[model samples]
Target chain A: MKFLCLECNTAMEFKETATPDQGSLTAIFECPDCFAEFAMHMNPWETQMLKSLDVQLGGKSEAAQPMQMVRSFLNQQNPDNLTAEAPTVSTEGGGKCPFTSVVAEAFQEPVEATGPVWTPEALARLERVPSFVRSMAKTGIEEFARENGHTEITAEVMDTARGNFGM
Target chain B: MKTYKDLPADGGSNIIGQVTQQVNRLQQRLASVRHIVAIMSGKGGVGKSSVTANLASALGLRGHSVGVIDADINGPSIAKMMGVRGQRIDYGDDGVKPALSPLGVKVMSMDLFLKDDETPVLWEAQTQKDAFTWRGTMEMSALREFLSDTEWGSLDYLLIDLPPGTDRLPNLVDLLPNLGGTVVVTIPSGVSQLVVKKSLTMAKKLLNAPVIGVVENMAAYVCADCGKTEDLFPSGHTEEMARQFDVSLLGKIPFDPRISIASDEGSVFVDQHRDTPAGRTLIALAEKIEAFFNHEV
Candidate 1:
């Protein structure tokens, strides 16, 4: 398809269109006169517009399939933010209800993540996660103690056991 | 938090900058002094200061326009030894002028700043501060404002009588970058000989100043009654050492009982005993020193 070159303001032909996995769309258009490759916009709105146009040009409708549920499950399981409202279904006990599963999943905090950052949000979440986990874990243990009718149980007992057992 | 730019539009406010400027000043000019000889020894009891006083006197007597700067900041013995104690520096528009010794050399010392002659330097780390004061005054931008600063004018030689050691005030000698050289003094004794070696090595390493020669003071005691010479230590250790170092042998000063008495009487040895052996040796050494200055080695 023909298009107006953004840089040289001349007529140009579309060279290629590449769709990125991370919701970005890029279109390479070559100017005939200046022989320059003019890059289109890079924001989300531009990407959405390019995708819609691709569908109108007899291109297959690239349905925005929501990310795989398991992929998101892995992401929500990120140790970065314990409060990120992740979906939960207890794998060990399918008998547990959704709320109970969420509580269990949220309480089962991962060990401190020391791996290289794979995303910006992951880094930001990492900074805030440790303290959040500590408080949530404290609340969870206290709730477990009360539920089991062991209301008098204290952190000292937990600490002693952890220390003796090499927890 | 005032920056260098916000300094009070005056030179005195920025002391560090002023001192740095002064150090650079000496670094450029230390080697330019016609004759810069630092007199020092490692041990203090060896009468290094008295020897410095008299040697400077002897040099002045030979008609050289000499200036003796007492680097012994804490224990400035030059004023008393040179018999210029309690003398106030003459001040006018120029700066503080160094007091003239009886024998013609211009003499300066920190002692002159004391309120009285009997005042002992009681400051702990007094030596360090004195050296600092000397370096500051000698190099600072404010030097032009003081009269004492003006006294160190052009001269044939500037003899610095340093505090007896390679440590403490010896670093002050490094301040005079153009220092002509050094003269190591030692009394005739095994301990003094070993200590004087340290001083010589320090002069070579720390000051990088040349050791023109070594002078053994009180090498032999000559009895006035019998006219027989007693070997106080080994008679010619200084000579042997000088030969080893390949420096000029600047003769020895015998343990003339008269030298002590003359010093006590506020008199220099060469002045009292111009015909005596000790005086003649000093004269000969002075000749050799003059020869060194003249490049007639």
Candidate 2:
């Protein structure tokens, strides 16, 4: 039977087309797109052939333990494409569009709105300004907020706008 | 033929989105310009366009990269004054290519769109009595479209020749992000200065634009034969405005009849006569402008 390539989900041919050996729990599948080989558990093992292969392969005997041994092999090779049965790789910000990396690089730097957010009380005081100079007065207040490093517009900022900035 | 090519190519489905796109396009186009200045007068009969043409020519001749935008939507004369009148704007791989003048100043104007000298730009609104009543909103959009679409590659200076009054100032002023400043033009008469003061206050308080200085055009008459200066109009208001408004007093220009004559003849007086008193003053004005941008003054 054909199996799905873990990385690209493409149908890939198995190295051995016949029915899996009885009680041989693991089978090897190769992905054609990424050329990564992964071991998938096929059935339970009834014999100690795994132990014999482990001795021949000269590796840790733990790799021959059970159905979980083959899954660990799949985890190492296709780490990013895992599911629960088949889990998707989800990061902190969730899945990103494949096309957005270049655009994200451009917007990496953002202008910080460092000034204090305008207070309603101060905004009401600014309401006394003539319509003609309203924008100018608001800008002066914000500029004062930024230059003075205040996180919120207080009575002091309004006083400065009135006296120094000619509001 | 009607040429609306400067307009954004949308068929009017999304108005706000299209205008925002146009603004984004203009910001990208003009980002390379170092200084954005406009020559404005509070009233007409101030020879503002002539100053713009000659000043841009002087700057260009001084080896500075300068471009002139005749932002006078209704009465565009920079094309004629710069001797680039009747040159048609074309579309190449770039956007609307501004026509270059004989002095190498990239000039853009609505005059280039008219078929002939007699054709009037009547952007009419539907009225009960008048069929050809021009609309202010239409004028603003057209000016914005032209300003946004022109492919001015790069420059050290872009001097916009604004139409007189505060009405259309927003049309051009809204397009510039960092306007180096405006060179407010006015004659020396009290009436002219009084009107110009309105513009200064508006710029400082309303527009929040920096007013670099005031240029007193037609301030005096300098006799060519006797080297005597004559007071052509009341001569004290410019300095008074400068002192009261806290704006700099850039040099003054004498009322030279030849200045007007040369303008009408489509010749740049600053380039033709550098030794004449008026020419020297023009060159001096150009120097002061250079110093202002250079932060030397």
Candidate 3:
């Protein structure tokens, strides 16, 4: 999608993308002629559509790895050798696009100040969950704990959350 | 006032370049494969995966290197039927190595990556509330990865076993513009043909891919003791459908309980029971596929 600056009647260039906030992505575009910047906020569905396409918002600096989309986005994968860790992306030399990091960070569970704290036992159990779904499960369990008025997430809290998850 | 065409590019996103790279990777990966065929049955429960597994084995037994892609992303069964389930896939220089069946056919399927029998394929999403908007695209991306990122080296034939839907072929054709041909599978029942005809039209007219022919699965049931064949589904509709489509009736495979048994046991039926009625037909079906590519049929 292209953005045009009405005042200058010139096309805008992609400047950078901010880290997703609550599943929404904000991309900043600047008019080449006027040097004026504008932000485009994409809702959750649009963000997901971009993620599903497996393309970076800005130009990709590095070549994509084999099965990158499946390895990165597939939740609840087999724990066998099939769970081999995807190679880490090296953002060294500042060559990688900022949107690449945004994409990676988008899937991560946000650290909220009011979120329930995980006890040692609960954290260990969360580790046992398949790595792919571990973040999602942790988020769900913490949300459940908070909803149930539990400030500290212990094994009992995890057990109580398990019922909500049908696990 | 500037227009869309006035813009040099999509504001440096280079989305088209990235997509072109994806297509180039798929074409480069498939360069070594001589023929790529898609086996599809619009109607469910028609034994399309069974036919694919046995056909790959048959071709492998004939000294032809074969690879099978379980394109049915959500309901993949080819890896299990080909006896490659639970096999560890490693990353190679080219791509992720595919699982090898007993008869040496390479196999790639979502089944190989699933955690267990009961685990369903699910993508990591912030919310599945409105997944209908992007789920199909996710599945297609998975299929594209299976096609381009698997290390299927120097194959004589690569058969893609598609899911039960008339819309699947068009999705595949979008990914593989030069897909060799399509082998339509159906039972002898008119109900089966009713849906199979839509797939036939999809492959023949809509997409314009070559229709290799039709295979009548479970055309009849062979009695083990009496050695008599009984019509399983009011026979003769497959022939009528084939005549209507102007495609050859490739083979008629009788219903053999062992075929199901073998699939459940993760064994190729044709390999273990080559002399059986269904086994013989499966082997012949593979030969017919070869001939179709060679311009002999």
Error of 1 at B120 (Å): 2.0
Q: Candidate 1, residues B1-297: lDDT per residue as tens digits?
A: 344344332221222333343354343332334787777778777777777777887888889777777766557777777777766565323223577778877776656654354544332111233234333332221111111233455667777776766664344453565566777788878788787877777677666567788887877777788878889886567776677666666777787777677666656777778788788887877787788778787
- Candidate 3 has an lDDT of 0.80
Give the chain B TM-score achieved by candidate 2: 0.90
Give the TM-scores of the predictions, in the order they appear: 0.54, 0.59, 0.85
Model 1's number of clashes is 9
lDDT of 3 at A127: 62
Model 3, span B264-287: residue lDDT tens: 989999999999899899989989
Model 2, position A63, has a per-residue lDDT of: 10
Positional deviation of B75 in candidate 3, in angstroms? 0.6
The native-contact fractions of the candidates, in order shown, are 0.00, 0.00, 0.56
Q: Pairs clashing in candidate 3?
A: none
Please give the DockQ score of every candidate, comma-separated.
Answer: 0.00, 0.01, 0.32
lDDT of 2 by residue, A27-61 (tens): 34465677776665533221122221111111101
All candidates: interface RMSD:
39.4, 35.0, 5.1
lDDT of 2 by residue, B1-297 (tens): 212443332221222343344456556667778888988877888889988988999999898888888878678899889888766555433345678877789887777765457656642111213322224543554455455445677898899998889766665566675678899999988888888988888777655467878888988998879989999987788998999999998879888888888888888889998888778888888899999878898
Which pairs of residues have clashing backbones in candidate 2?
Answer: A23-A45, A25-A43, A82-A87, A83-A86, A83-A87, A84-A87
Off by over 4 Å in 3: A82-124, A127-167
